[model samples]
Target: MRVTVNGESLELSESTTLLDYLIRRNLNPAVLVVEYNGKILHRDHWSQIQIGDGDTLEILSFVGGG
Candidate 1:
């Protein structure tokens, strides 16, 4: 299946969850915010939310300052 992440094309296995994809891509959830198809997904819900083909995902990571 194909999905778009941050405007970049991504291919994933069928029935892959958002969290699974993130892990597969080596993304750190502790520092990143995940949005699925325009809705912001809570950290606790990432594992349950399934990603579909043609879905749009946006990932944002927070930065710390001294």
Candidate 2:
């Protein structure tokens, strides 16, 4: 399936979960928020949400500064 991440095109094989994708890309869910298809998805649901073709995701990471 094909999806867009932060405006970049990405191709993923069958049965890929949101959580799996994040981990694969070395993204830490603990410090980031995901906007799935224009809606903010709860972190608890990341593991269960299956990514579909043409899905758009905005991965925003939180940075700590003094």
- TM per candidate comes to 0.86, 0.93
What is the Cα-based lDDT of residue 45 in candidate 2? Answer: 98
1-66 in candidate 1: lDDT tens per residue?
899989999777687888988898898889999889999989999999988889999999999999
Query: Which candidate number would show the highest TM-score if scored against the true structure?
Result: 2
Clash count, one per candidate? 0, 0
lDDT of each: 0.90, 0.94
- Point to the candidate with the largest lDDT: 2
Model 1 stretches astray by more than 4 angstroms: none
Residue-wise C-alpha lDDT for candidate 2, range 1-66, written one tens digit per residue: 899999999888886899998999999999999999999999999999999999999999999999
Candidate 2, pairs of clashing residues: none
Q: Which stretches of candidate 2 lie over 4 Å from their true place?
A: none
